[model samples]
Target: VRTYKLDTVLLILKCTQESKGCSWYIRAAKIAGSDFFSVTRYRSKHTCSRAVQSSSNCRRRGNPRLVAAVLHEDYPGQFDTPVPKTIVDVVHRRAGVTVSYSTALRGKQLHVSDVRGTPEEGYRMLFSYLYMLEQENPGTKTNVQLDADNRFEYLFVALGASIEGFQ
Candidate 1:
């Protein structure tokens, strides 16, 4: 099992079996205000062995780049509707590597950001596009609703009978 401390951001791992003299343990601490972590203490190099067989196909879980590429390349149109199981199946089929749902989710998030840009940038582009549409076609009705924070809540656009079929 693994345990984490909130104050120092230290992680401790120990064998689940309740033995007083178990040498299998690891302790790691996060560098303060940094994205780095260091293993302060480690033992049981030989005392602990794999209790269950590890799959060779599980290597892709560590490769976010590969997972992102798979998500973007294989299911471009299904980005908003992608299921984690579908991603797992595709990665296994193409690269013969298995990944967890969380890994697939992270990869999907990366792919979405890569394709759609950040939310702030997207909102900026949206406003610009709306302005451009109003400029190109005069008398176009464009309405935007925002919350108390001035963030986007809703947007409505009417082309003002330019199409001639619908009023």
Candidate 2:
């Protein structure tokens, strides 16, 4: 098993009337290690299994890269996973509120996610959420401090570009 420094970030999601959506998150360190181990495991396990069959025919017929299919079971719509452009409403609603990052930053740590989307959109969305959070929390001042130097520099660099450039 591998270990990493703890981190957290804030997430906000719009709720459906019936049920609030949930979030699943992973850290960057684990993501890197998992990528490495997954490739190794896929090669070894698939090769071992394939050994039981006619290797020559199997090699010709199969796309061996299928072994690298991660999150095939949990991610909805593998073959049909709805792309963001196609499912704007679902994407908007599914991204319910997340609080891991802001809290982690308070403790001077980092957080990560593998969510696919434009960084500009994420920044806009997060800012909107922060405004709302401030509104909801009324009395207290809502201030955000970047704990990591890299993150602070990244935010500055990103903001320097035209907002649309991120999209």
Candidate 3:
């Protein structure tokens, strides 16, 4: 709800209970000539209590992709660092969003899948990738061995540049 439209200069957000007179709001303004937005004024305290989230009203459920993106920033080089408990705690502390164990697991899974696709999908795209590799390098060589069931068994790649430089 854009109670106040976010513009290049100003961004303001009001509490869901604004109509009920809950005085929780934040207003940030862009610093002139720089790309920084500073919190100009804020009433961080939510005077109105939020209604208990019911099963039907699960809008607060953390988005897996958003959780994954935040996790990436927190553990950039090491995606596998945080475990279940750590994941739950970290998201709550950093994102101010409470998530269940399953949501955390799903977020990690989503992040990993985005970075390194499923083995099946990788194998499916392997030939096309190698084709482009060959086209780019001009003298690249690739050998992919398939088993009786046509499953991937072996892969060998020798770039044309490497071959020429060796001689």
What is each predicted model's overall lDDT from 0 to 1? 0.71, 0.31, 0.79
Q: TM-score: which candidate is best?
A: 3
Order candidates by lDDT, high to low.
Answer: 3, 1, 2
User: lDDT by residue for model 3 over 54-154, one digit each (tens)?
Assistant: 23553455677767877778777464757767888888888877888888888888877767778889888999999999999988999999999987789
Give the higher-lDDT candidate: 1 or 3: 3
For every model shown, what is its TM-score relative to the native structure?
0.48, 0.23, 0.49
Error of 2 at 47 (Å): 29
Per-residue lDDT tens digits for candidate 1, residues 68-141, read 88877776745473676787787788877788888877888888877778888887788789889889887787
* Per-candidate RMSD, Å: 8.9, 21.3, 8.3
Judging by TM-score, tell me the better candidate of 2 and 3.
Answer: 3
Q: How many backbone clashes does candidate 2 have?
A: 16
Q: How many steric clashes between backbone atoms does each model show?
A: 0, 16, 0
The all-Cα superposition gives candidate 2 an RMSD in Å to the true structure of: 21.3
lDDT of 2 by residue, 1-167 (tens): 11223333322222121122212222332234343221111111121222243323322111212211222333423333433232323322343212232232221211112234457778658657666755665442344556666253322222323444555
